[model samples]
Target: MLSTKVAADTTPSTRNYDDNVAVDTKKKVDRARGNITQRRCLIDNIWNAHVVDYAHVYEADGKKDGLISKLERSWNVKSGTLNSNTRRNIFRLSAKLHRLFDEEKWLLLPETKIVDQYYEHYREAGYADEFPVIKDLSFNYTLVAHPDMRQVAIHRRVEGVDINTPGAFKTFIYPFDTFPVIVSHVHPCFVICNSGQKLKDYDKIVAFRKGDTDQRKKRIARIQSFSKRLDGW
Candidate 1:
């Protein structure tokens, strides 16, 4: 009789209000597990737009825009303002996507070659300023903030030789700190990929492209729909 009573109380129909909310939340969480798809969509939006712009510039005057120059043009950021972290993420993501999608050589120095050759040169130099500032190696280095460099060096295992042989550079470079390496070199005159039109339809992301008033309204409505539930949460 006790076991029967326990089973009856534990049934979904007889579960308490908190249990119902918990079950509902769990179901929603489970269904919301497409974060990777969402992130890919986000990155693809930026990438496809850039590729389209690249193709347009190329077709207009036979001029291929450097990736960073294109970004600076679009974003209105000053040159050399991009930190090492942002540059690193862009390089890694672009390289990964290129591998996955078989993107043609947009960069003058291929991503693998840049990582292997130019990036290794600065990293092994054992100093922040030792990172190159050349045009072809733009992807390899950036101005790292002193605080960030110090924080990274904290966990790094320092050697007596590393400390004794250098200036303040040793205070920054340590054995374990990767310090945000870069990927590909974007040459000034490199050829642009001509797949911008194809990339527009590649991921069906064009449906969510910027400047669609109706789609934007629908997205806002979806957000507001859940935002109303925040009070309950």
Candidate 2:
């Protein structure tokens, strides 16, 4: 059961991307023409994903006419003619738009929220009831301060999170290649969640498709060649 207190509501919440290097540094390494998805309008044009694994397809709206109307109106799906997709488009563009309106405040951004439940075995100690094992958390994301200080917000329904109790659970939320992923606990040797949990001391995950089995198989040639070179040395 969720409740919204209309009287104390002071903020408009929406999705905000959390790429914080101050600009878009991530690039598509092997972009294809046919599989690509490009969304265009008057004010913005964005190239979404033809293929993605660690990342997702991006979106935007470059239409200039909506700017004036956006500041004054709460434009979203279910208004009338505008579809749900357009409402979503506005949310993505909000980062750049809000930056312009606020004169660039980095802290105004909100990151995705995630919750986790971690349990320890009490059976060894002969206990029947479970102890504290759930964590509730939300991280606020801010761009490093360029390209209009990108802002994004997302909330995930964690199993057992009570806003009333602070610091009962551990949470992590960070921007991974511009997309925000929230996860709990860092596993060094274990596989990280494919959903985008960048653990501390983590390395980048390459996007690949098993459907392109031949492409991946071809990479083995490079590895074999390198081994031959080592043998020659």
The residue ranges of model 2 lying beyond 4 angstroms of the native Cα positions read 1-57, 60-158, 167-169, 173-233
Give the whole-model CA lDDT for all candidates, comma-separated: 0.26, 0.22
Off by over 4 Å in 1: 1-67, 80-98, 104-233
Instruction: Name the best candidate (by TM-score).
Output: 1
Clashing pairs in 1: none
lDDT of 2 by residue, 92-151 (tens): 223343333223222111121111111112223222134222222222222222222224
Pairs clashing within candidate 2: 16-151, 16-152, 16-153, 43-62, 43-63, 44-62, 135-169
CA-RMSD of model 1: 25.5
| Positional deviation of residue 44's Cα in model 2 after best superposition, in angstroms | 28
Candidate 1 lDDT, tens digit per residue, 1-233? 00011011222123232221233322332233222222121112222322211111111111212433443333344654422112112121222333322222111112334233333543364222333333443333211121212233321123233434443132334222233332232221121122231123323223222232453334323322222322222
Positional deviation of residue 206's Cα in model 1 after best superposition, in angstroms: 11
TM-score of 2: 0.16
Q: Which 10 residues in a row give candidate 1 its minimum summed lDDT?
A: 1-10
In model 2, the worst 10-residue window by lDDT is: 186-195
